[model samples]
Target chain A: MAKKTPLDPAAAFRVPSGLAELSAIDPAGTPIGPQDKESGAAALADLGPDLAALQEKLYAGATGGSEHRSVLLVLQGMDTSGKDGVVDKVLGLVNPAGLRLASFKKPTPEELAHDFLWRIEKQVPAAGLIGVFNRSQYEDVLVVRVHDLVPPAVWEPRYAAINDFEQRLTDSGVTVVKCFLHISKEVQKERLLARLDDPTKFWKYNPGDVDERGYWDDYQAAYLDALNRCSTDAAPWHVIPSDRKWYRNWAIGALLHQKLTELDPQYPPAEFDVEVEKGRVAAS
Target chain B: MAKKTPLDPAAAFRVPSGLAELSAIDPAGTPIGPQDKESGAAALADLGPDLAALQEKLYAGATGGSEHRSVLLVLQGMDTSGKDGVVDKVLGLVNPAGLRLASFKKPTPEELAHDFLWRIEKQVPAAGLIGVFNRSQYEDVLVVRVHDLVPPAVWEPRYAAINDFEQRLTDSGVTVVKCFLHISKEVQKERLLARLDDPTKFWKYNPGDVDERGYWDDYQAAYLDALNRCSTDAAPWHVIPSDRKWYRNWAIGALLHQKLTELDPQYPPAEFDVEVEKGRVAAS
Candidate 1:
């Protein structure tokens, strides 16, 4: 039997440097993968070892030498868009030691008092780690705008602020991959219903989802604005059509696999002489 | 084929509350799992789904209701005993969202200025998460004692301090599982030589490992003292036979599986009226 090669989702789904139209993307579509769940899952499992080995090399590079590079994956989406699911199925493939995961909830009083970037800056992955932001600095424009939590004057400059911050991170050797998890309004309602129907998932449902759903159009407009504006050469955004859970997970896995391969982190050369170390160990 | 039945390691290897003997334990023995490497690995892989489900229930119980419980696994072993290996094979099976991992290195100036646990207290897992400490507060008694990093006056009282701190944690809803990964001195020598022999593993070799090995007897004495003094009803130590990598990983997985099953976290009941929420979601 011939070996099955998988899609390069980093290319298939990558939004060009500066533009995105969420409405044009299909929530349930498989942009470039196996057409069904089983094949998609098999392909995902195939990527695991390669992904783990690549992530470890990146980690080894930092500890043994001057490799300072890190990757930050920013997951942005409305509630119930499966940000958490993608994290489990995709990012979970690597050694957890290689991951620096931070989930941003509503701001605490201390966080609200600082510049929005302050807390985020504190959590950027250390050298050679892959950092994932569950929700991120982009919320300053999305949620803070939609809920009228802040006046337009307060939230308006955040798009420029985010771009500047990402550019600075890139300049310092951080490669940023931003993914917008796009699910349709109808799909979101079905998901909410499923959460209500299942005892296991009830904890995931928020009562406030109804209020958010009422402003669906407004949220979409806000998201489109943020998506269209904040992307750049160093920090491009990928629109992951996330209605199908398997495809979403596999796509993110493929994307990460591609980026890490491009980074091509080498195991740091031994700092100590091999023969001397061998003698020391044998003697011990 | 009849199903394979694995041993309950929580029962098999758990050091009885309040006592331990490091010298009596065999590092290469498979205390409970299949003796062969391939069979042991199969058993560990077989455990993934159940462990993932149990962990998710704990997460759900916390999110939807009043579950405040958490589990902390403390992993301590001499160099090259495979602490990192166990973490990848075991903890990496569950949802990464459910894990909070901290690796302790030599204290920084800031850490040294405070009480030994000042840095540790900051990183405990939140409600419903599983926290893994790569090396833990026990180091106050082990490494500190071996190297004479502190006067006995400073390190002597730490055994009682750790007990008091852990007792408080148990009373406040944390379940602590401590494991001392046991590997023979000969195995450590072999492993160090292997690292020296492989280019890929050179990054893991530290020249100081030889210095530490020179004090092997002192370190074992220190480890024996800590393990003996610290076992309690709420926090017992399990001495994992870690020379065989597959068995070590499987035993830890089984130990965790048993503890989580005993915890038996229930999915929280729906907070909203299921019927009303269904109506709302359907209308949305």
Candidate 2:
């Protein structure tokens, strides 16, 4: 077997080539963005306006007579890893009109009748919108594998299917940004305990969460396999340290801001004579 | 024609019998809950722990083999009336695992192939869950009527169809709470302008919003018709004054809190003997 070369910090955060082990990356380490909490929060606030602006341009271009391109932010995390918080704090900065938030729960009987992605494909954001999948197609591999919902023969081929599905999305003008919110078992335990301690937080305290905690190693292994197999250049996965809520929010926000800035979407030019329309409106 | 009896404040916020003109309701008025913003926020915070506890009990009862009952919060509002905000601020307080958030956008070709309710029924929450519909089946009537997407004969009967559908859900263990976030035409224009002024808010600004504004009266009429026809004792429509964001969030939160409290779900007893399970665990 050929020896694998070490990846830079950026590459380290993402899945590396060959058999990548999630154990190599620290869930508590901030590989990208500010190391301190205050600075991380400040950075997130600074990027908010730019992200909002860029998202608008993308929305306008798609809605107007111009090329339509959009971004899909897929979030996957263990229980209490702040996926919901990320959606509220980071993605919430953008205009809700152009932002489509889809939270995928367990598959329904009808959804089970079809392929796993059947329900997901329907929720994809239209041209000029930002689609945020609270939990996404990746759950087919992660949760399904962890729970032994299907046989290996059923789920083993999903990696390639996911890659192909994403590639098609990319080819059709959607930018797919996947993030795995990594939190240590200790952090998760603390969060769970806090929920139990506060009466107001009781709604969030599920007994199932405690049961699932026992399968930590199994889930990590499943995630490692997924990252190694499905993290292609087209839609690579970013493993974000989520122990610190501030860093998690900042990193995801900055990552999205960078992606949108790179896309540099512009407002579409007027299809008709603007001056004439302006005059007509004024007279009316 | 007989003279319609005057309604009390609570009944007034709800649709009155007869024509039930939208023009009669004051969008700026806070018909229920705290009269002021500071008090509303405080009251919402005060109810947090109770709401959370009630929701947890509801979830636990369903999951633990007790009588299963869930709440479906259907939120409908015109552009800029803060339907998304209600989901975030009011509903976001609950645990995401037990909460299902579904945002309905423009229907795809596949969705259009079937009846409008087909797509909605799929997204209904399972037992032990609270389902929040950002936009819902009501759109079939509101937007369809406004745009003439369907003929009068097609859209006309849908009012009764919707009434029947909701009645069926009520017949099941589901408690449906429908809210229409009512805002003035002037307020919407102000919000649109604010989005345009802030670059970050550009993503939220849709030129089509202005076009839709042209059909303001038509939408109001459609909403009035839906309210008068569909507000049954099973699933009542609450017209919320949404011009104030804080009050809107508080009102919806309070409303949900009231409903769940009334349900008063109790956690189920252990299926197995506690002492035996404890002994087994200790032995293992």
Q: What overall lDDT goes with each candidate model?
A: 0.87, 0.78
Q: For residues A201-236, could you state the per-residue lDDT of candidate 1 as single tens digits?
A: 899988898888998888888988887788677787
**lDDT of each residue in A76-167, candidate 2, tens digit only:** 99999999888767876766556777888899999999998899999888888889899899899988999999998999999999999999
List candidate 2 stretches off by more than 4 Å: A1-12, A16-21, A31-67, A74-161, A180-225, A241-254, A264-284, B1-12, B30-67, B73-116, B123-156, B181-222, B242-284
Model 1 chain A: worst 10 consecutive residues (lDDT sum)? A1-10
Instruction: State in Å the error of residue B80, model 2.
Output: 5.7
Assess the local accuracy of residue A117 in candidate 2 as a C-alpha lDDT between 0 and 100.
80
Predicted structure with the largest TM-score when compared to the true one: 1
Task: Score every model by TM-score.
Answer: 0.96, 0.69
lDDT, residue A164, candidate 1? 94
